[model samples]
Target: MKIFSLVIVLIILFILVGVFVKRRSIKIRRIKKEFSVSNEKSIMESIFHKNFLFFEHLNNTFKEKLLTDSYVLSKLINIDGVGIQITDEIKYTIFGLVGLLILGDENPDYFPNLTSVVVYPKMYISDQRGQNKSVNLGESWNFGVVVLSWCDVINGTQNFSDGHNVALHEFAHQLDQQSGQADGIPVNLNNDYYTWKNTFDKEYNNLLREMENAEHDSIDFYGATNKAEFFAVCTETFFEKSAVMKSEHPELYDLLVRYYRIDPMKIFSN
Candidate 1:
């Protein structure tokens, strides 16, 4: 009887060890797959793939820039059950490395972790009273999904020549929410929380004050409504009109550059 009980305990211990080792192996594989960097062959393949035309219209240097590694790209493109309709310049506009590199970069923490994306023909209007023909450009839900209108995507892309892209604006919200909230504060920022809060709050309120008086500004008035909107609108301009934003709102532009950890003016102006 004693021998049988000892054998049973040994079998259970071995089974538990086997399960633990298997689970650990799975976790390591998932991490490695998620963080793999781009390479020559992958870049070439991405360039030739039909879907990659999204990056073709941009300058050659920008074209070669990898928007995201395979892992991140897969995660980003897998937006939750949403339909992605690639059309017109959207394929090119979205493929441009500017927005991806600007809004997403390599940072997995404060970036679009949403697994699914839905694209529309253009500015999709939601017929709510008091709202005219308005296109609901992008919406980042807590459920790890995002929606975008390609028309707005192109418009925002072309307008990059001026200073705005609705796509970037919406995605910035997704990035903010990676920390689990879209309140303009990212989880990985190194600044003192209180300082960031005070600066953003003050600037947000000031923008609201200016918008109420109809003052001319580089950022869209929509940004004045709230902190999240402010982050989104500023991102639109950051990639679209970096020079203008840097010139008009130097402090805001600098802050954005620091937050995103990239300088579009350096990329675009170079």
Candidate 2:
């Protein structure tokens, strides 16, 4: 009886090992398939069967079915146990940001350190004793959490052309934080820091110089406050107002184009 029991246990262990290996192999193959093909519907079909629904079902945000790279889609789906109620619309927005991050590079490890995404129903006030202590639509923590207002999110989505998105702003900070301190410089750039600094410094100084007498007619005035904030605001304008930004700040626009691997100008042109 003891010998028979041992054999059964070994069989079960082997079965478990086989199952794990098979699933891992399948995941790898699917990810590869996702990258080489533009057939997003096939991927969706795969998700529909034997998949974890991040929510009961995402409510349509009227934003047409958007598709992203396979690796990016995996990262989006992998946020399963992230401890946040990311609805369908929020997921789409998150996917959009993820797609933007990966647009520059094939890798999707943008904001790799971030783990939590807390979405509030409305704007939340910060009472942290150390910080400036102001009511904000969104906040990004270096430790790992990003807080956002749902109302602002809806508004931002509705006006995709507007250079204002709370989530996008905070996520830009998260990208900045990957290096340490939200000083606007991102880690692991394909180009040297001098290029980033020069263009950013020129634009930032221009904003400040304009503010000395009167505000400039272009970009956001708030960006003049600091380099970090300037980068975040620029990122907003980069995606939302590509054509305007390109025409207004061609150098800055070119730098963003290289870094993000996206061309909002092309978007509007098309």
Candidate 3:
């Protein structure tokens, strides 16, 4: 009996050691990925299979430039390249979404500092803060990476009029952080700071007051959480539910139209 007990103890030790080694290896790989750089490919990215009409209808010059930017942006991101990993598909879809998000920005160097777009298959739970877990559909880290759940991505793409997209929400956070702070203010907005601020601040306050008595909101209630989240939520709504957003909140919609440089209501109003 003593010998059997000794054997069981050894087995448990071996299992624990194996688990530790695996976890350590994963940690090492993630650290390496953080600093790793990748070479850009010359191949042009396309979403022909998805038949996203937004790109299909654009003029050739604008279309080519858009595709190139997205290809370059997606290539810079690192992810799990093995197992049931779907980074390849994620990159392709992200290429499309990124192109759509930056349509208004004239700068060719958009998202210059972003390096990674991490994605999981479903809801990504973040439990890293003080023993509390924060459940997330997507997140954009200030560390040059945007995280997402592919399931949410697909659903968001398919239901493009829902005003909720994990990819857009996270990427909008990236935009907000581009100016070095994630305060719902982007770099270069200083020129139009008063207009943007008044519009955004008023709407944010209105939502706060209204949500106190209501369960549903014309805009995502999450946008009312804070300024940073408000911007991200607005991005999702701007691209996904533009027509509805325009009809309900004309000032906010007009502000988004100017900010994003797109007549989304015209394009998305099918």
Better of 1 and 3 by lDDT: 3
What C-alpha lDDT, on a 0 to 100 scale, does residue 99 get in candidate 3? 72
| Tens-digit lDDT string for candidate 3 (1-270) | 999999999999999989966775565445335424433222233342363545555656555556655664554456542123764556667766877777666653447557776677788687544547778877777778777777888788777677888888888888889889898886566567789999899989988988897856668998999999999898888877777787778998888777777777665433
Which 10-residue window of candidate 1 scores lowest in summed lDDT? 103-112
The sequence of per-residue lDDT tens digits that candidate 1 reaches over residues 1-270 is: 999999999999999989966775565456445445535335444533444333444455443334433333443354322245553234334434324644434433313355566666655665544547555876666566666776666555444465566666666777677777789886667764676677778778888888889898888888877788888787777777778878988877777777776677665543
Off by over 4 Å in 3: 1-62, 81-83, 127-131, 268-270
**What's the ranking of the predictions by TM-score, best on top?**
3, 2, 1
Candidate 2 lDDT tens digits, 121-192: 777777655888788888888886777777786677667677887767888888888898889897776556
Ordered from best to worst lDDT, the candidate numbers read 3, 2, 1
The C-alpha local distance difference test score for the whole of candidate 2 amounts to 0.66
- The per-residue C-alpha lDDT of model 1 at residue 114 equals 56
**Worst 10 contiguous positions by lDDT, candidate 2:** 54-63
Clashes found in each candidate (C-alpha, N, C closer than 3 A): 10, 0, 0
Residue-level lDDT for 234 in candidate 2? 90
- Candidate 1: where is the Cα deviation over 4 Å? 1-71, 79-112, 125-135
| Error at 114, model 2, angstroms | 1.0
